[model samples]
Target: GLSSCFHRSEGFMRGYPRVRGFYEVLSSCFHRSESPEGLEVYLHALQLLTTIHHGIQTLAVAGGTGQALWTFLCEVVCEDLCQPDDPPFVLQEQKGLLVHALAVLSVLYACQNQEAEHSEADTLLPLVGSMLRVLQYHREVSSGHGQKEKKEEEEEEKVDEQLQALIQTTVEFLSDIITHLTKDAVCELVTRGYLTEKTCLSAVGSLLPQFSPAVQHLVFMLSEADPQLADTVRKEFPVSLSPS
Candidate 1:
């Protein structure tokens, strides 16, 4: 059981003072190891992090305890999880860790946005970049997989769906961030290659209905970045000089 496992693991139980630690000695072994052994420590930490994230998400859904999880997520993002160096692992393990971390952070931000009265765009922007980097890496791996199984239509569809979801979430987050940034920042976002034509179209289609004229103009500028996309937009959204 999870309770038993938690009780047996000191590092996992450290955050829970009420519980007696059973694995304290084994946990000390982690701290005693050298920097290279930190990878093993991180593997354990990731396990605990996964449990905490899921437990908090569940509590949030039940209206029990979400803030604790949110705080933990912030700490993990700032301190532990976003390491500069990738671990030396098999491809599968590396991919699994990346996907798990990205999924947890994505849910955390989405929940925070939904629960808060105002937007937390600043806090979320960097997260969007991080998630994009992970997704881009995943997409590259997936493209290779797709080529390897080019004739397998079902497998290709599964890969496409995963890629599409990543793209959609990225566009949504970027759109939200753009809404809070200056026009210059928004322009820089496009010029820096962070906002592509597909993302721009997605952002416009999703944000235009709710944003102000200024935001609409920014979206217009983004859409106009690509003439082909601009022409498509004009055709799809024909303007009328006269009032309806």
Candidate 2:
């Protein structure tokens, strides 16, 4: 029954032979008359993706299946439903999808074997950038700051907590992946602007308390690659502060 459901639905349209079908479904979800129903169907597909991710270790060894699922999920989230004028869903449902999708991708990246030696940067980096953009858009829409004043104290604190948690999970996952990657790959990610100052700060603040010494050192190296991030750290963590 599960296999039949996946076969009949758009979820099966992920790999090379069915990618066009996958894109068509996504495009239809974006612009068809049955957009809301399409969205629900897409959500169902994502749930199936979660199941596939959970079975990766046992059923799929090379990680290609997981990567394909990740790529499709990213396309649906970042490309289709993530547009400016997209219809609203229940907020909690939307957040659940975003969080789960992100968490699953993190797991896939972390679980790759050492002998694989493949670069997932092409797949993972865009997902991270898109997630950041979604978070930024949500913050903007909810807080109404419009690039003028700094976010209000209450608003900033709330968003900072949510964003920090997401960034922490992502960074922890990436830190694990970084340990397995070549130094040149790590340096390339830094130099190519994939790891921005804001991302570095948020990740460092959240991850420093959890990761081991070696991971922390890697994070520090990545953080130091951005001069603006160093200045931010100095300002936020100044020495000799007066007692409150």
TM-score of each: 0.38, 0.52
In order, candidate lDDTs are: 0.43, 0.50
Model 2, 82-186: lDDT tens digits are 543443222222554455456656655556553452366665555545544454444444455443345679986775576556545555665565445454554
Best by lDDT: 2
- Candidate 1 regions off by >4 Å? 1-93, 114-122, 143-188, 191-193, 196-221, 224-244
In model 2, where is the ten-residue run with the lowest total lDDT? Answer: 235-244
C-alpha RMSD values across all candidates: 9.7, 9.0
